[model samples]
Target: MAAVNVALAGRSYEVLVGSGLLGRVHCEAYSFLEPYGQRSIPVVADANAKRLLGEHLQASFRSAGLSIDWYEVPSGEASKSWAELEKLTDWLLDRGITRSDHVFALGGGVVGDLVGFACSILKRGCGFVQLPTTLLAQVDSSVGGKTAINASAGKNLIGAFHQPALVLADTACLASLPIREMRAGLAEVFKYGLLGDAEFFARVDADSNAILSHDNTVLESVITHCVGMKARIVAEDERETKDARALLNLGHTFGHALEAETGFSDTLLHGEAVALGMVLAARFSARRGLIAQSDAERVADALARAGLPTEIAALGLDCDGAALADHMRNDKKAEATTVPFILLRAIGEAYVARDVELADVGTFLDEQLRAH
Candidate 1:
C-alpha cells in the first residue's frame, strides 16, 4: 500500500492506493467513517458498479457492523446533471444526513463528481470520501477537489473545489473495468507525463503494455506516481489562483471541444477526448513553431501506441474547425475574450498560451482534420 498526501493548510488528506480496499473498508478506511459513530454510512454508486460489486462490499460492511444507506445513478456522462444532482441531494436529506456524516462515492469519476458536488452544497457543506474505482479517477479526479457536472454550455462548467475528506483508490476494482475504459484511463495517466515529466513519460511509453495487462505492481506504482504528482500540483494551487493547477488542463481545452462536438455522450469517452486533445495540442504547438513536428508526431505515437485515439479524422466530425474553436469559447479557462490553450514546448513540457487567436486555432484544427 502507498499513501500520497494532498497537503493543504488545514484540509490535508491521504490518497491511499492499494488492493482490495473496498472489501476491508470498514476496518482499513474506518477512520474516515468513524466520525459518525456507527451510523449507517451513505454510499452513492454508479449503477453498473452497484450491480457488479455491491454484494461483496455489502458483505464486508456487514461483517464490520456497518450499514449502507444506498443510492445509485446510471453509469454514464448523463448522470452528472441537474436532475440527478437534485435527486441525490434530496435522498441524502431524506436520510437525515448531517454535516458530520461523510458520504462515500463509489465507482468512477461520475459518481465522485456528483457525490462531491452534492456534499459540497449539502446543508451549506458536508464531508465526503472518494472511493475512486476507475483508473482515470484514481490517478486524477479523486484527489483534486475539482468536482463538477457538465453544463449545457460545456463540460465541468457547474462545479466547485470542495475537496474530499479522504480517498481510497482500490486498484482491485480495475479488474472489472472494460478494456476501453482501461485504455481511456491511460490517457489521463499519459497527461501527467506529457505536461511535465519526460522520464515518467518514457516509463509509460515502455510500460504501457504491462500496465494494460493488469500487472498489479506496475499499475500500483504508476497510480502512486500520477497521484503524487497531482497532489503536489493541487496543493500548490488549490483553487487555481496561480497557473500551477491550470497546467493539469493541458489536453482538456481541446478535449472539451471534442466532447461538445459529440454531445458529451459515450460516443466519446472523456479520456479518449483528452487523448486526442493532447495530440492536437502537440500538433498545434508544432504548427506554430513551439516544438518540432517530429516531437509532435511522437506524442501522437505514444498515445496511439497505448490504444488511445490520436487523430481527429477518425472521429468523422462533421463540423469545421471554427465550430470546434467556438466550443472552446465556452471553456471555463477562457478569459473575457480569450480562450487559453495548454500548448507544448517539448514532449514533456507544456505551457499555457493565451495569445493564440481563435481564428488561428480554427485554421489549425482544419489542417488536423485534413491530415490523414
Candidate 2:
C-alpha cells in the first residue's frame, strides 16, 4: 500500500491506494474512524455497489468487532438533493447514529458527495470514510473534502468542505465498472495532466493502454499519482480562498455548465462533460492567443485517443455558444461582471482569468459549435 498525506496542519489525513484495498478495510483503515476510536461504522452506499461488494464490507467490519449498519440510496446525480440529504439524516437518527459514529461512503462520486455532505451537517460535523469505487471519485472527488448536493440553481450549489478521515481506494473495484464509466473517469484523470503536469500528461499518453487494460500496477500507480497531486493542492488551499485551489477547477466551470444545461442527466456524465469542457477551454485560450492552436489540437487529440468526447458535435447537445454562455452566467463562479475560468497557457500550466471578454467567450462558443 502507498499512502499520500493531505497536509492541512492539524486536520491532516492519509489517502491509502492499492488493489483489493476495500477487502482489507478492517485491517488497513480501521483507526481513521474518528471521535478518536469508533468501531460502529454506518455504511452509506449506492444500491448497485451494495449488490457488488456490500456483503464483503459488512462482514469485514462485523468480524472486526464492529457493528455495521448499511444504508442504500439510489445512485446518480439526482440522489444529491436536499430531499435525499434530509432522508439520510433521518435514517441515521433512527439508527441511533450519533456525532461520534463514522459513516463509510462506499461507491462512486455521488455516494461520496452525499454521504460526506451528510456527515458535514449531522450534528454540525461527524466522521466519514471514503471508499471510492469509481476512478473519478478515487482520484479527485473522494479526497478533496468538497462535499456537495445539487440545488435547482445548479450543480454542487449546496455543500461543505468536510474532509474524509480516510480514503480507501480499491483499484480492484474498478474492474467491474462499465467501459463508458471507465472512459468518463479517465477524462478527470486527464484533467490532472492538462491543468498542470506535462510529464504526467506524457505518462498518460504513453500508458493510456495500460490504464484501460486494468493492469493492476499501472492503474494503482495512476490513481495514487493523481490522488497525491490533488492532496497536495487541497492541503495548501482547503477553502479555495486563494486562486491555488481554483486551478483544480480547470474544466469544471464549463463542465458544470454543461451538466446544468443537461439537468445532470445521463445525457452527459460529469467526466464526459469535463472532457469536452477542457477541449473548449483550450480552444478558447487558443482563440484569445493565450496558447498556440497546436496545443489545443494536442489536447483534443489526446482526449480522442483516450476514447473520451472531444467536441460539442459528438455530445449531441445542439445548444449554441450563446446558450452555453447563458448557462455560464448562472455558474457559481460568476460574479458581478466576470466569471473566473481556469484556463491553460500550455499543457501543464493553468491560470484563472477573471478578465476574459464576454464577446470573446461568445465568439469561441460560436466557433466550437460551427466546427461541429
TM-score of each: 0.98, 0.96
RMSD of each: 1.0, 1.8
lDDT of each: 0.90, 0.85
Which stretches of candidate 1 lie above 4 Å from their native place? 35-38
Model 1 Cα lDDT, one tens digit per residue, 50-82: 988898789888997778888989999999999
lDDT, candidate 1, residue 79?
91
What overall lDDT, based on C-alpha atoms, would model 1 receive against the true structure? Answer: 0.90
Show how many residue pairs clash in every candidate, following the order shown: 0, 0
Deviation (Å) of 39 in candidate 1: 3.5
Show the lowest summed lDDT stretch of 10 residues, model 2. 31-40
Tens-place lDDT digits, model 2, residues 19-65: 87887888877665434344356789988888898877877766676
TM-score winner among the candidates? 1
